[model samples]
Target: MQTAQLHMTMTGASEPRTARVWLHRYATLSAFCTLVLICAGALVTSNDAGLSIPDWPLSYGRLVPPLIGGIRYEWTHRLIAGTVGCLTLGLAVWLQFADPRRWMRRLGITAVGLVVAQATLGGLTVLFFQPPWVSTAHACLAQAFFCVMVSMAVFTTPEWGSRAGIRFSGARTTEKLAMTVVAAVFLQLLVGAGYRHKGLGMNWHLAGAVIVTGFVFWTVVRALRYNATESGVAPAAIALGACLLGQLFLGGGSLGAKLYYADAPQPMPIFVYVTTVHVALGALTLASAVVLALLLFRSEAQR
Candidate 1:
């Protein structure tokens, strides 16, 4: 036995079965809650609701705001963010003080780090007026950290983690291809973020989702060409394809609005709504890539 495992065995008294069950339950709930928090923030951007409050850590100079009218979206997003922050903070405490596995303890620490990093990114977004790189990185990190949280949950749960034997020898060729598609999709997401922040390319952004369309098409093509039919990577490929189609319509709608305003008596409408949806979905593309990467990593670990 490994030294750590040996030590654990030697010194350990039995943990109450019920206690372990509760811990597993808590981790499972925490993971799902964290995922919901992630989607809430995504919608904040999707609806151009970030600046609705026009302040950080407070909405309209208050910690809590009336949730009537459009403030509802912004305020609700904030409330959910606060709740998520607290839940993760609680999860970290539980892991540190209660969880016995050495690796899980480290993962809890990593989760804490991710929370801190995410908060800092949020602050930078506010202070810097939502710079594209910072915002996109902030957004991408949330999704990445969500996956990490999911992994932690997976490791902690009894029915999930203990039985899934590691496979270190598997379809090496397919695994590498899946990994490659994920990397390309991640790059495409970053590029799409850059495009969203482009001040001069409003029209092109609307018309130019063709770029990502081709990328997703390529990703799907490759996934079909390589991965096992039963693997999770195929769904990610399908998601990329779906998101790309949505991008085309959202991009065109945004650009169409811009051109329409250019001809109207009123000022040009803000492109943020369309832009942010594209931006948020772009994050989704990155996340789908991340999941595919996880599948590849799983395959490699098993081998």
Candidate 2:
């Protein structure tokens, strides 16, 4: 989730201090931890444990009361989420001081804002009794925060800034197309995650996967046809495209194969694991695609 790749770069600036490197390192780690938090929240939904806590911000009215805890599944997720939120808040403050870039600082602020909003959504999910849209928004916001965090990590590296003379063809058309994919994949994920959380309407999620498949197919084709860059970006588009296609197959097959075989006599564990992998890969694909698109647009804009 730490941007496109971690190959690092040939930095001319006498590689920054250990502390500076540590800051970037923690920011990336916190962001990834947030990603897992989102997935954990999804698992809570999948297991029907969302309301098991039944109380706001306090696990049964006490902070350090119990680790053996009530509602093993639900309260545990809350504790993890609490940890992630604090980590992100720390990262936000650290970014403000560590990176002097105004835009970067603002992005950190926006990330924190998203964390707050997502926390509010989580509370509403409990207070309102698991409204679908609210839960979906919570999931969506988590993805957004992940996207920004990865970008922050990328920008912090010396190779990304004014060197490499790297220019992207942000041609409005391509940029918009990429953004459209980001929006499409994100929206589809929202629907899918909501379904799994609410434990209802497999059909709806399957339908979403189908629709997302179309958008992803078109995205790959567009990148292939018009994106002239054949260096770093070329591989990104290919890798992204392949992952999307593979995800579509895995996600669809997970549900379909489950139904098909379950109706018979016995089914393989593949069904469950397939779904798990689908969801995990879905997160990965969403993150990587957005990063690729942002890099594409950023490089293009500088030209």
Q: Which stretches of candidate 1 lie over 4 Å from their true place?
A: 1-39, 46-49, 66-71, 96-101, 131-133, 153-160, 163-171, 197-284
Whole-model lDDT, candidate 1?
0.62
lDDT of 2 by residue, 13-95 (tens): 33344445677678778867866776676556544567777777776787643444226657767778788779878877886
Per-residue lDDT of model 1, residues 13-128, tens digit only: 34433444576677767767766666566556655566666677667778888676556766876677667677777777877766656677788888878878887887677767
Q: Provide the RMSD of all predictions against the true structure, rounded to 1 decimal.
A: 5.6, 5.8
TM-score of 2: 0.79
Mind sharing the TM-score for model 1? 0.66
Worst 10 residues of 2 by lDDT: 1-10
What is residue 35's positional error in candidate 2, in angstroms?
2.1
